[model samples]
Target: MDYSALRRRMVESQLRTNKITDDAVLDAMGEVPRELFVPRALKSIAYLDEDLQIAPGRYLMEPMVLGRLLHLAEVKASDQAMVIGCGNGYSAAVLARIANSVVAVESDAALAQKAQELLVDLGASNVNLARAPLTAGYPAKAPYDVILFDGAVQQIPDSIVGQLAVGGRLVAVLQADGPGRAILATRTEAGLSQRVVFDCSVPSLPGFAKAPSFVF
Candidate 1:
């Protein structure tokens, strides 16, 4: 398969048409080999316009969705960022290119190890890969300027919100009321304010599912 051509087409067609206009984001997406992030069996479909399941119930977001989320995060060169569910570290590698520093958290031990190897191979010196529960944000590197959940979730726990610095921003695809919505939540002195950015369908992260309530 001609992976390079496929990747270029993905950027020009899916990404550009979808409004991922940031030159930096586009360049990163174009240059980074998406095939390297997926298992060998699925490398051929790496650039396809869909999510590739990385594990049981876990998937890497489609390129367009990820690019849009990064653009919305407004990553700055001086910003400190954290990425939740850093599956294979593709998002962290992209964030590393734009942000000053990045802490990528992954819950699956095997995936975390794979991400670490890939990040090192990619020479992403500014990004650190850590293994932790998906819902439990890395507190040791708390107060991030930006927090990105690479997958969908049912709720954003205070445990995660507490890691953000005042005035910081968090972007995630959350299940609001019913269908999934991409939301940008910002921290303020008064409280957190959330706004839905777009409608999206993404695989939910494990351990983030809301428990059912008993009724009479």
Candidate 2:
């Protein structure tokens, strides 16, 4: 299979058509072999515009969704980044090309192991794969220049927001009501300020759903 051709098509059709205008992000999305990050049985659909389920309750975000978020974050070549719910490190691989270094945090052990191996195989040396709770946000590698969640969340926990360096940008698809909205929050002197960027459809990461409230 010609992965290069498929990736090119994905960039042109899914990403470009969806407003992923950043050159660096387009380059990275076109370079990363998304097939390797997905189950072998599903490799044929790896470059599709939809998300691929890489593990139980874990998904690789849709190409356009990830691309748009990365474009909005504007990851610089010198920036340090952290990806929450990295799912097989596909996002980490794409991020490694844009950021100086990336710390990928995954909550599932099996998924983390797969991500580590795949990242190593792909020569994504700049990424550090850590197995930890998704909501905890890997504080040991705190103060990142950018933080991204690869999946939707009911809310952006303070634990994750607090890990961002001043001026850092964090982006995620926030689910509420009937659908999810993509938002970007920048850490500022006053605090994190957020604005909705676009409407998105994506599954929530493992641990970010809001707990149920009591009823009368």
Candidate 3:
């Protein structure tokens, strides 16, 4: 299997055609052997156009979706980033290429360990894997320049939002109401400013589900 050729095809077909125009992002995505991040059985399908399941309720975000969200976040070479739900660490690997460093938090112990191993093997030295609750952003390393939730969520917590440095950007897919809306929120002196970047549908991260409302 010619993974390099397949990766190029993925960049041209799934990404460029879908508006993933950031050259740095495109190059990073193309260079990362996505197959190495997934289970052995799924290697052949790693570059496919859809999200691939990494766990029971978690998925590796589709290439275009992840690409566009990262594009919207506008990561800089000197920026610090935090990735929630760092399944298999693929997102963190891409982010490490853009940001100076990345702290990836994952609640699932197995997933966290797996992500850590894969990231090290891939030589993503700037990523720090944290096995902690996804809702609680890694505060010890707070004030990050960018924060990304790798999966859809019902609502992003204020605690998580507060960790952003003033002028920092956060990206996530909110799936509370209708179809999911990919959003970008920037921290400001006054407050956080938010805008919908696009509409997307991806599996929701566990523990981010909306609390049930009572009905008569």
Candidate 4:
């Protein structure tokens, strides 16, 4: 499969057409070889503009949604960023291109190892891949300027919010009743406030499922 051509089409048709106009995001998505981020068996469908199931219950986010979230996060070249559920580390690689340093957290040990190898092979020196439970955001590198959750979550944990610096941004797909909402929550002097940026569905991150409440 010609991944280059497919990637070009993805940027042109999916990203650009869908209003992901950030040049940094467009260039990074174009430059990163998506095929390198997926297992060999699924590399042929790497740039298909849809989520590709990676493991039994996990998936990579679609390109357009990922691009839009990255753009909304407003990653700066000098900012430190944290990426939750790094899934093969593709999103982290893309963030590394824009952020000064990136700490990518992965829950699965095998996927973490794979991501480390792939990032090394891709020469993404700015990204550091670590194995951790997906719900527990990396706190060793606390006070990150931006936190990006690579997939959807039923709710954002306060623990994760505590790791961000005041005024830092957290971007993720927040699952609501009707549909998944792409939200950008910013840490403020008073408290964190979130606004829905767009609507899209992405696979949910493990351990973020809302707990059931007791009956009245």
Task: Find the 10 residues in a row with the least total lDDT in model 4.
Answer: 49-58
On residues 1-216, what C-alpha lDDT tens digit does candidate 4 reach at each position?
777888889999999998888898999999899888777888888988789887877788999999999989888888999999998888998898888999999989878888899899989998989788878798889999999998999988888999999989999998857799999999999999989989999888888988887999
On lDDT, who's better, 1 or 2?
Answer: 2
Alpha-carbon RMSD, each predicted model: 1.4, 0.9, 0.9, 1.1
* lDDT measured at residue 117 in model 3 versus the true structure, 0 to 100: 90
Compared with the true structure, what per-residue lDDT tens digits does model 2 show for residues 1-216? 888899999999998998889999999999999999989999998998898888877899999999999999999999999999998899999999999999999988888899999999999999999889988989998899999999999988888888999999999999967789999999889988899999989988877778899999
Better of 2 and 4 by lDDT: 2
Worst 10 residues of 1 by lDDT: 175-184
The collision pairs in model 1 are: none
Q: Provide the lowest-lDDT 10-residue window in model 3.
A: 49-58
lDDT of 1 by residue, 1-216 (tens): 888898899899988998788887888888888999887899988998889988787788999889989888888888999999998899999899888999999989889999999999999999988899888989998889999999888888889999998888899998746788988888899999999889988877778877888999
Error of 3 at 18 (Å): 1.8
Q: Return the lDDT, model 2, position 166.
A: 93
Which residue pairs in candidate 3 collide? none
| Cα TM-score per model | 0.95, 0.98, 0.98, 0.96
26: Cα error in model 3, Å:
0.7
User: Candidate 3 has what TM-score?
Assistant: 0.98
Query: What is the alpha-carbon lDDT for the whole of candidate 3?
Result: 0.92
The residue-level lDDT of candidate 3 at 32 comes to 90
* Cα-based lDDT for every prediction: 0.89, 0.92, 0.92, 0.90
